[model samples]
Structures are given as C-alpha cells and as structure tokens.
Target chain A: MKVQSVAVLWQIWSRKSFVTSSTLRAFSTSLINPSNSILMSPSLVSLDCPDTWTSGSVQSDRSSVQKYTSKHVAQILDGKVMAEEIRSGIALEVKRMKESIGQVPGLAVILVGQQRDSLTYVRNKKIGSEEVGIKFLMTMLPDNCTENEVCKALQSYSENPSVHGIILQLPLPRHLDEGKILGLLTLDKDVDGFHPVNIGNLAMLGREPLFIPCTPKGCIELLLRSGIDIKGKKAVVIGRSNIVGLPMSLLLQRHHATVTIIHAYTKNPDKVAHEADILITAAGVPNLVCRNWLKPGAIVVDVGTTPVEDPECEHGYRLIGDVCFEEASKVASAVTPVPGGVGPMTVAMLLHNTLESAKRAFKFS
Target chain B: MKVQSVAVLWQIWSRKSFVTSSTLRAFSTSLINPSNSILMSPSLVSLDCPDTWTSGSVQSDRSSVQKYTSKHVAQILDGKVMAEEIRSGIALEVKRMKESIGQVPGLAVILVGQQRDSLTYVRNKKIGSEEVGIKFLMTMLPDNCTENEVCKALQSYSENPSVHGIILQLPLPRHLDEGKILGLLTLDKDVDGFHPVNIGNLAMLGREPLFIPCTPKGCIELLLRSGIDIKGKKAVVIGRSNIVGLPMSLLLQRHHATVTIIHAYTKNPDKVAHEADILITAAGVPNLVCRNWLKPGAIVVDVGTTPVEDPECEHGYRLIGDVCFEEASKVASAVTPVPGGVGPMTVAMLLHNTLESAKRAFKFS
Candidate 1:
C-alpha cells in the first residue's frame, strides 16, 4: 500500500515539479536532522491523500487539491464578443449624437511610409470607423517625408474643425524624429494617447488622461467584461513596451492590482509568472508561456500575435500568442486567445476614444 | 527540551506575527488535511533550532538565517552623507563651467502663496543654490494674485537668457488651477519636472525626461549610493500621489524591479509589504509601517515627513516619517531616517537638475 501511495503521489506531484523542488529539498534535509521532526509534518500531508486523483474533472471539487492539479480548462474571455458589444453600443451613441448635433465624429490617420503592417492597421482602423458612423480621413506621405512635412499635415488635422481626433501611425521614417512630429499634434486631437501630456496624466493619481492607449485599454476591458476582479490580485505583465506593457501595468495598478512588469532583462521570469493570480504577456515572443509558467487557474491575457511559419495553414503562416494555448488552457481559469482577442478590442477602443473626443468637443452629454 | 524549543519558536514567530499568521494558518490547515503531506514540511521548519536566537547581532551576520528572523538592526541609508557628496560634485562642475564658458547657471523660483512649508522649502533651495555657486532668482505673489500674474512672472523668467531653470513652489492658492498655470512655463525652463511633457517622458520607455521629480530622484540616488540592487527585486511603494508615490513607482519600474503600489484601496498591504525586497513609503501617515510590516533584511526609504505631536521636544510638534522608526530599524536590512534622509536629498537633486538644464541649454558636455 505504501509503494502504491508513493507512485500515486509522484504522479500528482510531478505536475508541480517546478515549484515543489524546493519543498522536496527541505523535506529531504529534514529527514537527515532529528530536530527537524516538526518539518516532517509537511511531508506527511501527502500520505493522507486518497489515490482518487483524476485529471479530468475539476468542477466536482473546489478544494486545494483541485487547485494544485493542472486539470482545469480555462473559459475563453472572447475579446471578439466583448468588442462587438462595445462597437454596437458606440454605434448607438454615435447615432444619438449625430441626431442631436447634426455632425458625426471625425478621425484622421496619418501614415508616412509604405510599411505593410502600418497600412493594414490603418485600413482596419478606417473600417472600424466606418462601421461606427465616424468620418474617416487619411493623410499618406512618401517614405522620404521630412519632419516638417509630417508636422504640417498633423497641424492641418489639428486645426480642422471637422476632425475630432488625430493619430500618427508610428515608425514615421529613419530620418525624421518621431517625438518631434508627434508633439505637433494638438493634445485634444491626439486620439492614440501617445501624447506626453496624456501619458503623464495616466501616470498621475486624481488625474485623467484624454485617452488610454488602445491595446492596454482593451486588455483591461477584457478583464472587466469577463468579471475578472483586479483589486489586490497579483498581476505579472511580461514586456515593457510603451504601447502595451508599460501602460497595461499602470491601468492594472489604477484598478488596484499589485502589478509587476517582467521585461527581457528580468531574471527568473517563470518564477514570477507562476506566482501571479493574473498574468498578462505582451512580449511578442511566440508560445513563451507553457502550463508550468502559470499558477493553477490564473487569468491570462496573451497580447503577443507573432506570425510563425506553418505549412499546414493556407497563408503559409499562423498567428501564435505569447502563451502556449493548448497547454495553458488546461491550467488557467480564463484565457484570451491571440487572433480573436486583443486585436479587435484595440480597434474598438480607438473608435471609443474618437467618439469621446467628439462628444467633448461638441459639448454633448 | 521540546517545550522549551516551542516557547523559543513562539517568541521569534510572534515578532513576525502579521506574516506568520498566514504561515500558521497554512500549517494548521495541513494538520487538519491528512492528504497535504507536502504542506506539512513548512510547519516543521520551526523545529530544527540550536537555541542561539538573538535579535541584536544582525548587523554582524548578514546571512539567510538572519533574513528569516526580525532581529537585525538596519544600517542607515544616510541621505545627508550622500547629498553632501553630490553637492560637492555639483559645485566642482559649476566651477569648471564658469572657467570654460564664462557663464554660471541661474534658477528662478515662483512662489504663489505664503505657505510655511513651501516658504521653508524655497529658502532651503536658495541656500543650496548659493552654496553651489548658481545664481538664484525669486518672484513672490500674494494669495490673491491672479492667474495672469503668475503666468506673467513665469513668462518673464522663461524669456530671460540667463535663467536655465524655473520651479514653482507647490500648494498654490486653492482657487488657482495649478496644472493650467504650470503648463504655461516653457518646457526647457521647467526644472521641477512637473511639466506634463517631462512627466510623460518619464513614464514612457526609451524616452528621457529633462528633469526627474526631486524627491523620487533623491530616493533613487540614495539607493544607488547605498549599493542596493534594484533589478529583479520586488518593490512596494505605499502611496499613489503624483509627486512622490506615483513617480517613485514609475522610477523603480524603470530600474527593472518588479513594482507594486499599495494605495488606499489595497486590501492586503501588510502582506504585500512583507514580501518586498525593497519598500518605499510616501503615504504621509505617521508610523504606518510597523516592524512586522517588512521582510527581514529589506531596504526601506521613508519619504513621509509628517509633523506629529511631540511635547517632550522644544517644539510642541516634531517631524516623524511614515515608518515607525525604532521598530522598523530592528527588522529592515537598511532604512532611511526621517529628517536627515530624503529632505537634504531633495534639495540636492534640485540643484543637480538645474545644472543639467543649464548644460543642455548651453550645449555643453
């Protein structure tokens, strides 16, 4: 019976091999020291468990035993569904505003170069605007556009009475200074929330930013709509990019979570990630999170959408998130999928911010 | 002998009452759950002791065992000493600039009201500037001064070719909009780093601010001078105010530390503080940090300088830091004392920022 119990224990314990190694080392050390009889109490805990360990059913039990085992499959957050709901709500608001004020919200997107990714993003934004009844305007400049040329275009957008929001698609050109060109856009018209004043306000307490960065804002919306409570939860954000990780952490902190950001320079990231009740990864590294890296039943939002070669797919590439989906889905309580998750939410948030700007500009309730 | 060991364990454990309660709950639960043998190992860790527990000699032996017990007295992170060293360095650089460029740095201070603390701070900054050979200029306005008056004073200073930096003493008359008035100052002349653009830069990655907030910058300087490694460490800042807590948290995050801020709404601040390798308190609550509120051997910086009733002193009230100093000294690895720690450093950082502004304005190396 003892031998059979040990084998059962090994099977259950092997799943938590990464975290339990230190505990096992302490247990082994206690065996060598007679004075460590009190320490033996922990090892005896395994002896009391029945051999009825099953990896398939977690709903039947909500005890620590179930928590320790990686048998639970996460419920999908479904950002796509939430975003569609928000877009519909925004469309209703737009309709009401246009009826009252006889003017629709307008957004201007400035694209400098022929970068395929930037062009695609701009097109998606335009489509989102059209769906929401927002007037979409675009300013396309050559690859060799000067800083002055970019600044001139932004100033025109800022001065235009019809344009309620202006966004400069990032990575303008190698020769032009991005900061200087962005600074030319008036604060009220900076819909992307990249303006320093907006970012500074976001960092300050008792202050409100004109707009939160769309991607991070979307992550927060996903958590909120899915009923994931952020207050006092241990949240680990992987990546420190300004657009995603930095602002995501700030938003989480504002929501009163104990937030930690793990960047490329971070040591022992897996250990940190495993300790979090909520884990958000924007590291752009494909499949960085496996089952072991997550706390059992943690809430996860994977922001990374990297294109990896896959002959099995028709496009010759498939989108993979920072999290290993198949394995992580078994451990996390709720997880946001890569393609259908944060991408649509970002576009939705952008439209939301533009609508807000128009309302404020037009003096509507 | 077993009873004696238990008693001794109780005494040591009681010192960490807040933290050990969770541990004890986990231990007692293991006793109830016969299946949790692995959880039992942690409870037994208290049994293997050699009866040589003493709280006094922690300064002598800096080991892991010492870290587990709240016996070690913290080394003083003396900000006075560091500030003196920095001021001397700044003075030497000022002398070199005078000899090379035949021009010395100048600073302008704008005081809107006659608040006692603000007056004292402005006076100390003047003294520090004079001691460092920088030209000092001041413009004092009455409590009833109009917003235009403040803006006019700021504009004059901004246009002055000799003035390198401008600072507005905080707590401007309650009626005036502080943010709007401050925004009127040109970015280059804004040395206080409270300008939205400067703060925005501080919040963003890959961007550097023209000046960092003085108090937060001083905290970083103290930590750096004390040889405290920030990278990969768990840091907790107890406050969310714009000037101190918010910027301090941002600065720590920039240094690559896993950071958490415990604001008014945080549910388990004590547990959060106990887990931090580095803790900074700027909440302005006197004696908010108790001995049990720290991880043994943790580094602490108290930014709160609240005036509390002290009838024994010549003055009826005395300045007390947010931390309960006597108790915290016994638990922390290093701690900054109230009056001498962050105060002098704030003044020193002001002078340093002014020098940097002058260097940048003059295009000097």
Candidate 2:
C-alpha cells in the first residue's frame, strides 16, 4: 500500500518552501486595482530568464479600482435539485430498457469492516441504486478477512455475469492493502474509476475514461446543466488528491478550461485561489476559502465534508464544506453548500454509473 | 481517418485566430526581457460568470511588482548525445539476453500502404532493429487491403511466439479502421505505444506504461542526462497532436512540472511558449521556434521532420525539424539538430521497448 511510505510522502509536502508567503500576499493585494498600469503577469511565475526577472517597485500611480456592489447573489448550484433531475433521466432509460429488452442493470457493492462512515455510505449507495431501479448486491466482509477470501468474493461477482458494475467501499479496515485490492478489480466493473489504468487514460488528451470518478463527473454535470462556459476558464482546483481534485483538473482541461492546482503546501494558495474564474475546493479544511480569497463573480464548488458541533441542532453536529459560504455569497456569483452541494450528487452519479455499466456490458436497449 | 476533417481544421486555424504574425513576433522580441506591464490571457477564455458580471481592471503597483527571473538554463540537455548513450546501453542488454536466453527479441512491423514517408520510416526501422540485434519482420500489405486484413495480420503476429513486439505501421492504408486494428494489438507488445490505452497510461501521474512513445521518452531522457531540473518547472508544448506535443505536456506535468498545451487556433501560442523551461516543437512547420522566440538558455528538443531543398546534401533535400535549428542553437543554450537529434533516440527506444516486452513476458534477467 502507498500508506507504508505515507509518512515520507507527507514530509515531502510539510517543508516551508523558499518563496515568501507575505510577499505573495502583498502581490495579490496590488493586483486588486483595475487601472494602475497593470503588470500583465507577475515575475513570480515566469521561468524564462531569472537574470532579467525584475521586482515591481511601487509606482505612485493609484488609478481608480472598481467598487463591489451588493446586488450580486450566489448562484447556488443546488446539487440535490440537479441530482434528482438526473435520477429521473436514468430511471426513464432503465424503464425503456426493461420494456424493450427485459434487461436490468446490476451493481455489486463490497464493504469490508464495520466503520460507521463506511456503513452509512454503503447504505446510501444501496438506497440510491434501488431508487434508480437497478439490481444491487451487497457483500459485507469482516475486518479480519484474508486477502484470498476477499479475492474469492470479488471473483464470484466478476464471473456472475449478472453483476455489471462493481464498487469496493473505500477506507477498508487498517490491515488491508488498498491499492492492490483496487487494482485487482476488473476495469469494466470499476465504477469508482480508481484503477490506475483508467486514471492514466483520463490524463491523456483525446482519450476519454470509460468512467470518470463521480465527484468530478458531478461537477461537470453541475456546470453544463447551469449553462456555464467552461472553455478556457481560469479554473483553480484547491487540492491534489487523486479522487476529486486531480481528476477535476484533467476533466476541466479536457473541456478546454485553463486549470491550476493549488494545494496545502503551495507557497501562496490563497493568492492563487483568488485568480480563478472557477474555484473548486476539496482540501477538507474548514473555512479555507474566505470571501477575500475569491474573484468577484466567480463560481465556487466546495467538496469538503467536515462536521462542526452545534448545540442548537438536534443531531449535535452540523455539516460544513471548506468554503465560508456566508461570506462567498456576499462577494461572488454562485456557490454550492456543504451538505447539499456535491454530497447528494455523488450518490446520484453512482447509480447513474451503475446503469451505464450494465447497459454497456449487456448491450441492452 | 482524421484527415477527412483536417482541411476544415486548418481553415479554422488559419481564420478567426487572434494569433497574428505581428503578435507572435512581439512575443519573439519580448523573449529577451519579460515586461509584466501588458498581457491579456486570451479574450475568448471564460470567467464562468453570469451576464451581470462586471468588468474590472487590476492595478500594477511597483511594490506589487515581483522579481521575475526565469530559471531557464539549469543545465544542458542534449538529446542526440543522450540517445547514443541509451542505444549503447540497449545493445549491451540485447547481447546479454541473446547469450543467456538463446533467442533474440523480435518485432513485427505491418505496413498497409506505400505512403512515401511511411515506406522510408519502415526501411529505417528495419535498419535500426538489425543494428540492435533485434529480429525485424516486415509485412507490406497493399493500400486496398480491407480492415479485416490488417486485423488478421496483427492477430497472426500477436499469436506468434517469436514476435516479442508488434506495430501496425501508421498512416495505415487510410481506408482501414486504424482505431479498431490498433486496439486489437496486445498492450504488452504494442511497440508503437500509439494504442490509446497505452498512451493514456503514459500520460497519467502515478501510472507507468510498458512502452512510452519514443519521442517523448527521448525528450525526457535528454533532460535527465543533461542534469536539467524538470520538477516544478513551467513547460508549454506548442502542438497538440497525439504523436508528440500533447503527450509531451502530460509527461512533464506528471513529473511535477506545471504544463500548458497550445494547438492549432490557439489564440496566443507564443505567450504560452515563452513559459517553457524545456521547449519541444513537433508542429512540422519549418523554422517554427526561431531565435527571437527562444528564451535564453532554454533546452529545445526538435522533433519536426520537414524536407526542404538543400543542394548541399547528396539527397538534394535536407531534413529539418520543427525548430529553426541554426537560429535556435545560437539563442538556446543547447539544441538538437534536425537529422541527428530525436530521430535516433526514437529507433533506440523501440529496441528498448521490444526488450522490455520480452523481459516482462518471459521474466528474463
């Protein structure tokens, strides 16, 4: 598992880089004015000629800067609303297939161990599949199961012919080798699309993945449904993890958007974040994206899922994403909330992916 | 074939393009001193904003001006020299394999048409295979051969125990379904590395390919040999063809470099090109990367193969790469010559790939 060297990987990211953070912040503040002789690009990013690279000295030219207006309201990309719409689209397709060919899609779910979060996720996935009228198979393996036992369970489902799509619930018990198990699954049945081969395909230009991971797909669906122009947009993905942020950058670039990935170790993450036409944050940090860390009228998609204790709520804990939603709504155009933004759409897409997998596998109507 | 729409593609590129020759020339002049005072990242680029999004300008204060020094000449990266070293390395390995295994690696080349360049390439490939002591098999089918014929030829070689590597020579009798036939070749034996799946793996971050297409591999090998630091460098590939430029960008990025790709109809190709620490030109346009366009000390890898009249050579026409070699060499700290640069490395890598395929398939030392 990559986790064995996880400490080394984390250490690589923990060091304070050579560039000064305060210098970067000051540069960002200066770029805020609309008409003070705009230095088109900062030298910080220029890699052409270090000898010729000059520092911008303060000139006494303070031209007029545009003032912000309060009329702007956040265009909530309510994922719950969009997810329901997509579910109906899938349901209609499923119904059509059943009527014409009597073929129904089937998805097999493998969950190892009894982690509370994993149980809840597996349950939600099962419910979502049912709602879409796809046949679902669930296998619960004990925490201490051997690799052979897990392999046997996977082999049966893979050879079952009835099982079209397969998903192994993530963050398996501590003893398991995650990468090996994920790689072992058949490419055709890998609904999560975490297979390195599939990911490798996604990174290439002109090659499309059989299935893109759900969150990135969900983000695309949200953008396209909202009629947003993705082409050549200055998009910043505020994380570098494989599942959400990296794939999101590739997908956005494929749609022709110019993308930059800023992560925790980035020297000036906030300054970089502010330059985005579209900002998608999945850093799992609370309030990492402040209102000031945004360009006016930019679209924001926050994918973080952190829980905060709230005594007033009956559940005692409330869900929140990485963005400061209240502040973002005041300054920027549109935003997706923590609980309803990307969360609901992820499950809805899983069902969508299952139906797709079955139809492709069976040559159904 | 993509050729059907290529004319329209060219028309689209030639017209409605904001990429003026004058602007390209300005970028050439600005290569000397990067003036951060004036630039607009292509106007057609999106903001993902609503109709009510107001236009704003950014002020450039001197205090805000950053010291921009391009870390251009980290070291010299000579592709031609490195290619010779790699070829010799492969020769030693092949000799050892022949002695121990009692069989040499064999590569089957299937050519379906008589495209002048394709024939020339096939002849050279055979020569290269012989030089490396890898057995070369060439099957020249007629231009009128059906798609099934090509597939059958590939399948026969795939089944042959002696055929360690296979390639369906490209520009493949244009009428044949190139995609389907190429897909049929076993991924393990795909020496051309053009199979979309193999190309995908090459472009992925953590994924590794059994065979990386020769040109990009040569480019990286050159940089590594020259002691150039690629990590965290900003690289821009000037063309988006699947063969070289697009994959080149992805490979650089996967190595932790920030990469940008420009293609036909790209609004500002020159602006993007200036950002590269390692510049690779495969556009086939003669003299594409000129003296004015080069950032001093940039490592240039030339992969263009345009035949231009040169009575000085016995062939009556001389071979030239995408780069204006003479001018680029003067401005660039190091540059690869047209004939001697990337060409030899490509053939060498093919030999290396066949050996790699044999090693993995037979588990040889």
Candidate that would win on lDDT: 1
Q: lDDT (0-100) at residue B225 of candidate 2?
A: 56
DockQ of model 2 vs. true complex: 0.07
Q: Candidate 1, what DockQ?
A: 0.17
lDDT of 2 by residue, B265-285 (tens): 333355556545678777666
- After aligning candidate 1 to the native by TM-score, how far in Å is the CA of B13 from where it should be? 40
TM-score of each: 0.77, 0.75
lDDT of 1 by residue, B1-365 (tens): 00001111112112232323434544454457664321111111122222121122111212342443445578999876566656656676677789999988999999987875566567667777877799999999999999999999999999998999998877788888887887798898777787777787887766777788877888888898788887668789887767777888877777767777776655456767887889998877678788778888889998877765679854355676778889888888899987778777777777888998898888975
TM-score of 1: 0.77
Q: How far is candidate 1 from the true structure (C-alpha RMSD, Å)?
A: 19.6
Estimate, for each residue in A214-249, the C-alpha lDDT of model 2 and write its tens digit.
Answer: 788778778876778776566888765667877787
TM-score, structure 2 vs. true: 0.75
Native-referenced Cα lDDT, model 2 = 0.64
TM (chain A), candidate 1: 0.80
Query: Tens-digit lDDT track for model 1 on A101-156?
Result: 89889999899999755765677677778877999999999999788888888889
